[model samples]
Target chain A: MWQYEKKLQYPVKIANPNPKLAQLIITQYGGPDGELGASLRYLSQRYSMPYAEVKGLLTDIGTEELAHLEMICAMVHQLTRNLSEEEIKGTPFANYFVDHTTGVYPVAASSVPWRAEYIASKGDIITDLHEDLAAEQKARTTYDNLIRMVDDPDVLDPLRFLRQRELNHYQRFGEALRLTSDRLNEKNFYSFNPSFDKHCNK
Target chain B: MAMKERIYAYDFAIVEMNLYLDTHPEDKDALCLFHQYQEKREQLIEAYEAQFGPYISNVNDVQGDKFTWICDPWPWEYSKEV
Candidate 1:
């Protein structure tokens, strides 16, 4: 059961409205390596995780990803708020404007709608953890790309914070992988699917 | 700082401590901090809800529910107001 917390995990206050930047940052909100996908993937995978530590990691990180999702939405909201009609028609966001009209929508920078196919839930602990680790790196890289593109300190501050969080989550996921591996057979970690096979006897 | 700001601070500390405790569950000091702030958070929530409005549902006995949990002037809205 989750309780409502009315505060963002990290504050996002963008003073200037730049439609071009909004078009780019919207990617994090619903792009291929978006936080929405990350949150759903880990939360779904946790149900089948074999060990307590890994499950806890997935739950915690997945919850954090939800927080990230909120921050990204906040960014998009503040960025696109109160745009003039001319600004909308002059910028690339004119296309998005026609559809969303200053509303927050989850679509990639390329204008692709968010899809469940962006994430994988294999139900295997090893497979899921590896996927999670890779996901973190991908997210970090996306943030890096965003950081390079934007010069506004307002946007950059939160982007840096989010990037750091991805690194921290990567470290925690690595620990989860180690904890899971330690319990498996020393001879062959791949001998069985600990989540499904009752014979492993961890 | 305003009461809302104080509550936000407490909640932020609790969140950071929570993430730490998840990975280091056996760490006694982190556990202690988490419990301490959790209680502080609950107390602040109670006090704030009594004085200002309900930030959390049913943490304190709020009067005459019109389903104010979905009320306007949300926390994010308050930040902008500040």
Candidate 2:
């Protein structure tokens, strides 16, 4: 059994209700490259990962993504906490309020609803590991952008925490890739899997 | 604390699952933990529905007569309620 923590992995408090910023940040919640997709993808893909280290990395990163999901939801909630119908209808939040009424709905800034296409779950370990690496980098870039767009200490506090997590995840995933590569080397007794043929035999 | 617990349970499962899988990828120990976490998650979800009205607004699964016993009373209404 896992123990629960009362505190967020990082503190998240949004003092002002900026629905527009919240709407934009919702992209990190449910966009194609959002934390939701990131969490689900990594967690689901772990079983087939060849190396135990890589599998562990997926689980760790995926779990953190879940926290990120909550942080984003909190942001959205704070942003629209007291939004009136007229206020909501006057801004892009109108689209969200029509459906969720202050509730967080996952989607990119482009308004594309959450889709499974965001994740790449090839059964092949090599392909999947490479994809995981790229995904971390993508998320890091997104956090950097979010940090730049928002300047509130409340918002910046969580954003900074999340950005640090991105870097940590990137470093871990990079190590995982190395571990997987080492496994391939030991199994082949060769320098590398040049053709990618053996591992690609799906 | 209730909302935080819900999130933590899910995250705890993810972290524990990864750690277990790191060494015992198929040890079944990790799988057992996975099941435990999932069950806890269901209980938390029920608790959430009971207290917060509903975690998801459109869904009403609290009526026991209906097959939607998924909702449990929120923490404030726990047996420890004042």
Candidate 3:
């Protein structure tokens, strides 16, 4: 069961509206390595995770990513809100405005719409944990890129918070991998895929 | 910060502490802090809903001529200039 919390993980208060920056930031909103993907990836992968701790980790981290997604959307919304038609005319946001008209649409800075194909929920425990580790690194790199591009302090604050969270998630997922690996046969780590080959593991 | 904003801050602290406690169940200090924040959060929510509207959906018994539970200025709209 999920409970709704009325606050964002980190507050996004951008006093200045920069559509150009918003275009880049939107990538993390719906892009391949974005929070939305991160949330969906862990949540979908949890069902097949072999251990209770790992499954619980996936649920907690996935829920946090959902909050992160909301924070990113809030940043994008504040940055693009109330844009003058003239301000939008000669900006990269022109294309986005044409389609969304200041509304928050889930698409990358490259304008690629979010797709389910970006994530995987391989039923194998080890494979999914490895993927989770990689996904966290990818998200951190994306945040690094966004931090380098934006000069606004307001925007940078929340982005830094999110970047720190990616590092935290990476650590958690790494620990989960270790925990799962420890449960497997020490002589042959890959003796069996615990998720699918349950009979041999027990 | 406003009263509502303070309540949000406390709620966020509780949520963060809860996640930490989830993975580190043996951490006594962190567990203590989580309880502290939880208490603060409950107090803030109670005060806010008393003065304003329902912050939590489960406790929405305070009725009025207008359904303050379903009013404007949602959480997203709070602190935002939109």
The lDDT leader among the candidates is 1
lDDT of 1 by residue, B1-82 (tens): 7776677788778767776676678999999889999899888878887887656534343459565556554433324443
Query: Compared with the true structure, what per-residue lDDT tens digits does model 2 show for residues A22-79?
Result: 8888888998778899999898887776555776677777877876787777777777
For each candidate in turn, give its C-alpha RMSD to the true structure in angstroms. 2.7, 8.2, 2.7
> What's the lDDT of the predicted structure labeled candidate 1?
0.82
Docking class of 3: acceptable
How far residue A85's Cα lies from its native spot in candidate 2, in Å, is: 2.5
Clashes (candidate 3): 0
True contacts kept of each: 0.20, 0.13, 0.15
Worst window of 10 by summed lDDT in candidate 2 chain A: A188-197
Candidate closest to the true structure, highest TM-score: 3
In each prediction, how many residue pairs overlap at the backbone (N, C-alpha, C within less than 3 A)? 0, 3, 0
Quantify all predictions' global Cα lDDT against the true fold: 0.82, 0.69, 0.82
Worst-scoring 10-residue span by lDDT in model 1 chain A:
A193-202
**Which ranges in model 2 have alpha carbons more than 4 Å from their true place?**
A1-6, A186-202, B1-82
DockQ of 1: 0.33
For model 1, what share of native contacts is present?
A: 0.20
